[model samples]
Target chain A: MSEVKSKIKRVSALKQRGKVLRDTNPLLAVFQWGCNHMMNEAELVSDQPLILDRDFKAFSKVQVHNQYYNEQELPNKFKVKEYCPVVFKSLRHRFGEDPADYLTSICDGQIYGGKSTGKGGGDIYYTHDHRLVIKTLAKEEVASFHHTFKQYYSYIVECDGDTLLARYLGMYRITVHEKETYMVVMNSIRPVGIPTHRLYDLKGSKVDRKASDKERAKDLPCLKDIDFEEAQERLYLGGDTETFKETLKRDVQFLEKHNLMDYSLLVAIHDCNEQTPGEIDRDVDVYHVGPHAKDLKADPKRLYFIGIIDVLTVYSTRKRAAHAAKTAKHGARAEISTVKPDQYAKRLLEFVSSMLA
Target chain B: MSEVKSKIKRVSALKQRGKVLRDTNPLLAVFQWGCNHMMNEAELVSDQPLILDRDFKAFSKVQVHNQYYNEQELPNKFKVKEYCPVVFKSLRHRFGEDPADYLTSICDGQIYGGKSTGKGGGDIYYTHDHRLVIKTLAKEEVASFHHTFKQYYSYIVECDGDTLLARYLGMYRITVHEKETYMVVMNSIRPVGIPTHRLYDLKGSKVDRKASDKERAKDLPCLKDIDFEEAQERLYLGGDTETFKETLKRDVQFLEKHNLMDYSLLVAIHDCNEQTPGEIDRDVDVYHVGPHAKDLKADPKRLYFIGIIDVLTVYSTRKRAAHAAKTAKHGARAEISTVKPDQYAKRLLEFVSSMLA
Candidate 1:
């Protein structure tokens, strides 16, 4: 083992010497050799029309997507300071050889805003060779992102028998011309069709069915009597509204009984005058808000829920809690308090139950 | 004129609509059309080398000098945000066609960072076409940057009667790799050599015998004995060191008599440490600490200097005085005192005269 280590060290020493030779005159042969190595390995990610057709099978679900553009049609201009060139370098370094290719594979090249399904950064395009078209962004313009890693990773661990949002692929920042804004690129599961359980109003049902692992593990909240339009109205135009705490409380209890996951919900309100086709929850993704929750609330459409990871529960909790948080904030500051994650979850569950009752 | 105004309003309306259309579907032709217009009118710049061979003239004397990486070696990499695609769409919406190209002309493509310059954001590379090689950078294992902008800009403004630094450029975020460490890029400035005056030694005999407008206009100080090394050391590692304060006083007086410019200085100190090359004036721009005074220590090899900006003196004085007033447990803080630009200049001259006497 020692001899092998020595051999490895010897090889490393030779590599170091070569690097020194290259730096002695970067204009020399060694520098060119490194550049060529990088260039040869990189494959431009070509642009693809959004996988709108839902043919998930044909898509690698993780294969590279390339974008191409005539120089005239590129989205961003070279900005010296804020939009400086080093951003490109940082991205390349982070992704390695085919950084562009790798990003293109997972990213959806669209300019998202309003009530997005939470996946967007800027206006991206694919080249014929699969190279991606990257543009400059500020903090507020991109749509939130929703990511799914389960399909990609095989080995999974159960932490307290609840699945958690493990990592983020990337985030989105947007530069708005009319206004300066910032938002995240988010990823969330899109429901193929409405589930049977969703159709029944959850207002007065007391038939407690035996908990199954599938049902318990799922993050969906029990559908209760809801007035979505009313909720939407209150959300768009700031005003007081009914609390869904009771409904949320019941569902949270159900989730707890099943040892379900913990997650958060965020809703983004784009424009008060413009009504979007989808809900903010549908458009945005699981964002890691290390702080800045107050700024997130500035968007009327955006409402967030925490400590429930199931997609359905995350969605429901967002919609219900957003309406509640908005109304509560007239005295909102009095109700919601940031606590330890576990304690916060318990309080959230109680809040939801009180609303339903 | 009325007709033209009406036309302008109509055009603005169309432009706004066009932006929304492209933003919604960046994949659509509308976005491509917008990009074309932006790029066509956009300015093109190069990732030229940061250093020049004395006579190289790709840039104006007022423009910055950049040293490009030897093509034989890896070019500087720039990492952009992943959601750049979405941001690109927004850019198109706002800037119209060829927005990217327009921005390119203005961008300097340099990254800056103090603590974690090269880590977390990953490595980036550049191609001859100016296309970026984006990569991921880790938060850990980053490299610090060495480019000096605040110092350079300050030096230029102080020594040369130029107000060019007022035309502020933006900052860039990038990552660089040197050996094993990585760093996140932050800011870059136009790299031009410091003017001869800013590099003068207060006590040195080699003074510009032919004084210019600003110098000739003032009551100049004739210092016979100045410690050039002490001045340089203070300039490199900032503190309210006795030598540094004295240098600032002299330099301010020089500016007042010669240029008729008014400014003040604020010296922030926490016990000073050994000088670190480019780290002294990280956030101290010309307007903040006054312009920089060049390092005229006998050892010409060292490029260190005292980077001071004028704005900092005025603004910081007001802020500091206010803060001091607020915290006073005694009588109200004395009327916020500050060194008026002219007064500052005179004081500097006085200090120099005293030192010489």
Candidate 2:
């Protein structure tokens, strides 16, 4: 909790005093001084009015504070309900306990990220019931802190060991007497025990055009190490070239981000008399060669590590030329010593994974 | 003409070429880039494309020189027949000669102004054949500058050489292309003998609040020569009470660009009146005003010069305050000085009349 507290910057008391719009009408405040919240969407109008009443400051601040409290506290109420069948079944499969199934829905407590940054936090929502918004409160004392929805959810999922993709369950658009309109969203309960990797295949089908609709309906893309050549071939088959390329690029990134693959080396298990690349078993999950390599082409039991010995090969020459072009654009050193092939492989994999996922 | 040429910069030359795609495809060109020209009233794209060609060097100077010459020499086939009744009537009124009357339609060399620019220039289109579109000869010329239809009519009515208001005739949408998709608008002619001051009443009525069909028809609050008091009042009327004072305060600009009322000195006139305590019709327009002053009273002989004295008084005080503010902002004294009432009054009259004829 202290770590989480340190991560968030507390909203200053000066900002909370409602001093921001003393010279303008609160209703038209957004028009006068443009709203910083999603400011990109609206245009600023000239000749906006001013608010003059000093007495309204305390009342406005209290109203804002209460809204903050209401948002967090009310959202927790829906999580208490045990009626969700999907959540219940997932819990039973994982823990073999029907009575304690709903405990998974209970929040372990939210972790605040650095800021309410666009690239950072998770989006939290309340259930349809107004009671769910009370999750924001702590004994009616509003503690102001900033956090992004992405970071918030990432922290929660990691701590709770759940594989649920956050989904909006409901929303309430409420207007306060003196303040602006606010929308509070409620999210459905997430279940545990399912692997994180599997969730990507399940939810990713919506945007994944590489898989046919019929194939997607039957089975998701299996979470296994993909062959680099086959993936590149699929991309080049090219009915829709851009789409295919993007799909392959994202797939590579996904593998690297999750620490599943590298590019320069291949892990081979040859004791089963596999002669060609196609003979490799479906169960054989190909992993990238690690940085530490000694002997090559030894027995499987002897741990012969993956290695790229043909640096003078045509493929290696092409890779070096591509690297040089990129380096030149970035004003990097022209020397081959600056190139980090392993890191490049890792980044490439992550980029691919993000698109596929 | 040289002075006008000196003021204008030749930004770029555009080639008027269209692309033919499929049979159903609309003609495409560089000018229509980013625009929805397919829509009912669509014209040029919003983020206008670079109109000039990539290699901007003059391709052929002789070609452009010949192009302009050839266009002027070509006879207009759309000219009204010599014996036409409508042409005969217009020519009879214009020249009062039977031989001249035979040439029914004639080109009057004046650029029609008021309706578009809110300033009076020339009414050239009246005597010309209304159906004809006058074009430039160059194939590379852009359409907006290529042709103008003889749409508007203007007539001067006077008794004993004393000029009354130039009366405008009614407008007609002159279609130029197939399907009558495009139009050129002409001036709305008025009865010739109306007094010049009466043009304000006519212009005011043209702003139809009930004409829900036109976007510009919506009532736009025109701020003319509003003194500080009227300015204060209008500010309150426009917005809620909370923002009224603040918005007005921000708008109280000492060094007003006044370009906002480019057609008239009416805004300045209003401002002068409001600054003075008890004066009505501040006579600020009597001071140096420009062409956009149609909505103002400009009769110098009958005008009381008392308001001029008041304005001069206010101007001196405002000048002192303006100097102080500028010195404070820029940490230096500026060159703005207060004008004496008698001197300002004389200068104002000279500037105003210089614009009239």
Candidate 3:
């Protein structure tokens, strides 16, 4: 109804279209662009003060139009959103990341699946450099993330990014081909160039918590609580248990305070004799502990990898209902992922500390 | 505490910060960065099919960290969000905007306030070439925009970008210094080089809709509905009355259908005899109607600037409440901006068509 008629014709006049990033899917390409865009924007505004509680509940969103980077492989339009940028940007800063470099790592890198042995249904990707892990989130998990975002961010800031919790570098939602994918980027637990003989997802619950026969049939299967118990794997904390326990205690308290359940202590054991810890790739491990390799009493028998993973589950009305259902099904004493936050935290800490000796 | 301690030290490692756009504030700098980022990203995903109704509610968000450019002037960290990118991106395509060129026009070019004669309370900026107008939106106005966003997009698509309403290009929210600013970008109604000797805001309402004496004191004051009536100046719509009225009729239907109120037709009359319209820079006016200069009937008497402004108002509960109060205070027959959508649309169409005759 505009009388103007808009006859100028400027849209097609430019004709200079940017090429898409080479060799990727529509989702990944759009995601990469969002990452690049976000980092670039973050760099301009990172000098602001630390994130507050309210900031964690907020998001910085971007919408891409026709002239995005790769027109050929990517969709002409899509939506990408980053939740709690203030919290994560500071988290990245505390982790000593250069924003520009972060942009390159995500945008330039190829994002293929992280070679899952097929036990898990969720899709996961490893950054080309194997530094960052991009894990797809379920709808409910995404809701849980938002539900506890404020609490999680506060805990991270209070601990000064020093906790054992999985370092969540970023969270994003990208809509492609009419489907929405929510993802969270974290510091990878799987170290490159190091053959971790075994890995365990320790929830400290023994009831039906063992890796199935089908799961164990695969190479590099993620062992579970029962397998860990059966192996009698004592954690080799390298005699630095005080500080480690202190931090772990604080992190568990945080999980407990927020009613988070089902989180695990990811454990990777690297045999020192087979691969000496002499040249430790510190950049590859954010949760390793020892008298530094340069110290005189460095142990050659074992190298331990530890970080708390799967902290996104919060006990909400839905989760509470799940807990009730599981209790009814497995009887009240069953060890389930939906245990009350307090009991869950108490059991997790007890299991982990007993193994540390 | 993180056992790694991150001895790699990368912050000082990469000291080369990307250059900020020259001569801009932190808000504008981050905005420019966001535009560039979004454009780069959209290119990759622009191949996606058109947006559906569900897509209208979606958004793309990004969070930046410590490495944001122009950290000194910008907040250490802030947020930039673009709502409903899928719809707007495609809508931009319909209006003939190359995503890349739109990027350059907003990000690369120098952005300064559109030279206002200083009559309005809100801030308005123009692209360097004066092509786009960026105006701040109030909190309620932002909500209204979202409320009507779906309907507005659907109407635009149905009409093929044919409407007297402003070509709403984009909407963004940026948080800086603990305060958030909402902005909308639209095609400017000011014709380049054509001096609009007089401008009037015609709402067709007589409820004390007159510019105050203080407002009249300004160098280029915006005359109101009362002033317009007293002047008794009929709109010179030339011989093309049928199409204009038809467009007006349809536009009114849209406004009424959406329960919108308080919007006005912004009129700027460029006195062509003062400076012949022959050397008219068409690029300066993205909405010019006449065929190029060679047409014999091209009148040198006048150049009119027209576009609907302030269309974000919706007849929400609050507006309905206001309407009741106004009716009680000013009597039902008294005219005001808070009139019901039906009566409002009818009265508006009546006033405009009457002006044309």
Candidate 4:
């Protein structure tokens, strides 16, 4: 009788344990599930030295059916599509990110939704460690990403992942209840354990380029070009200036060649003087210190994290029409967000150059 | 103001979600976590066709630290050790199990604890689908497993996974609060969606081989030799009799050569008349049907699952002492559980042959 009682207690305890794994956000839960699944599947694949042309078009899709008895707190059925797995895996290798560590950061712990949504109206999330960012993308943006992915991969390989462009880690499409959501994972431009005193999203455009009144009301608003100019903000890269400028020039030129434009230079400034002395996670926060921080002439009070983001947008016909109207109204010399790729790249480089001290 | 309010609501909702992932069973949670982590790490390894001697000794150990900010509902610190990964992986392949599917079966769903513990005092768990069984092992059993692992791997390779031996899938050691527990994963002998009307753990011994009163009180008690004899149970294998006997002979010889004894033949009988018509999962329940079931003089109402289990126990010094003491007490000719490997095998084969028709 005592043994039977103990057995009953254990079985009930397991039932209680099962209840604890319930999904709070089904979408995020599915996304994490897909990541864990695909990453494990990728282990069986043999390593290839060269990425094949067909690899760019390749994808793995799985539809999961959750049975009644299973403990998975997911929808009854959902589909996950991983695009260009080999290409993305190579990109991850190029970025020096360990696949295991990447899996742990995204799937092993909580994923927190961003307090504010992206300008593109996509939802944003951060890993528990704040080492990676996940952003939902529009269908057209996914198409645009596929269009530029080949050149983008080649550029990443050539640059050895040293450019200031966003380090894209993985791309996936998740479908639940017939609704499809495309998401991209990237290294977070902000470092952990450091508070950013000021942030700027620079597009080299002055007209309507300042942070909105509503945006400014937030504790850490993304300030813009006009705001940057208002504060006369400058980055003291010192000896690292030439290397930084050269990489930016090459990156923008590559984007121009691909007819990509309207990308922003996201700069986060951490005031070293204000923060308590602590060890910085250099591996995760790769952009925290410039390569030549030990070369002297460094600003002891400020540490900077800088990267180019939103590079997926292309200068389409609609953008060209908007540019023509803006040019007609404000004269051809007027600084605007939308312009020819060449002119946009040149203006961004010049604007960035002015910020260097 | 509305945006801020919405953001607050979202944050609070997420907090509520995090609270839902609380751990009711920290040990099981950690086991699941470790499986996910290790399986993912295994994906990054290059495949090898040949299993080396060192592969048996090889192991991977990881210590996980769950910080306050992380959502992992585990102890603050725990250690997981995976034993003979490459060898086990090869064994899985030999058994025609996909690594990815194996990972998903254990990690993607809830693992239920058995209603009754094993006679060895080990806790038992089954995958949500009931396709796999996980049993906690004593430290000595783990050591015994390692001792025979090389010969076991060779035997498995030679027989090509066709023998009626337990299909060992994975073994792991988990540590929490400075305490260690070893666990092994194996294919479940019983078929899914089929009702087993009678179960038996036969060792060809009458002395102390009968199920206890407590065991007999269960819904599905594991009967013994005395119980089987009293009921006059027989297996009508017909055409499969020779093949079954041949395989059993070879398996017993293998065990005898390794000085192992005290193993049992686990037999589960599913009475078709007692079960509802349903498709049996053949992939998971590989032992459900006999090799020559079509040529079977078999009972239409009965389907059998038979496998050799508990084969890790070696006839060591302690067992030799127990054999002498038992022989002295019950007379040398008594059908006892403990005996020399050669005598034990002969007695078991003779007892099993008598029940075959």
Report the poorest 10 consecutive residues by lDDT, candidate 4 chain A. Answer: A8-17
Q: lDDT for every model?
A: 0.26, 0.22, 0.67, 0.72
**Candidate 4 lDDT, tens digit per residue, A141-211?**
89888999898998988877778888888999998889999989998887666677898989888888989
The model with the greater TM-score, 2 or 4, is 4
Can you list each candidate's DockQ?
0.01, 0.00, 0.04, 0.02
Model 1, B155: alpha-carbon shift in Å? 12
Query: What interface-residue Cα RMSD does candidate 4 give after superposition?
Result: 19.3
Candidate 1 lDDT over A1-357, as tens digits, reads 000010000001001011111112111111122222222212111123332212211111001111221111212221111111122222233323243333322221221112211122233222122222222233322211111222212111222212222222222222222233222211221111211122111212112212334433444322222322223222221221222343344435444443332333222223423434443343342232211111123235433322222221222334446547544654533333322234445754543333321
Per-residue CA lDDT of model 2 for B322-344, tens digit only, reads: 54665575555222122333333
Candidate 1 lDDT, B1-357, residue by residue in tens: 000010000001011111111112111111122222222211221112222222111111000111231111212231211111222332233222233432332222221112212212344322112222222233321111112223333443454522211211211222223222221211111112221122322312222222345433433211111323334323333332355445555555445433323232212222213334554453353223222223323222333333333221222344446546544733343221223346435554454344331
lDDT by residue (tens digit), candidate 3, B1-357: 001111111111112123345443667766765665544444444445757666666665555544323344445576677776667778778777666556656764667763344333456777765667788777887888889988888888798766778777788877656678777887766654456677788787888678889768865568888898788866666665666778778987998898888788887776656665456654444245321111111234665667777777787887789779988999887777678889888888888888874
How large a fraction of the reference contact set does each model reproduce? Answer: 0.00, 0.00, 0.04, 0.00
Better of 3 and 4 by lDDT: 4
Where does model 4 exceed 4 Å of error? A1-357, B1-23, B114-118, B277-297
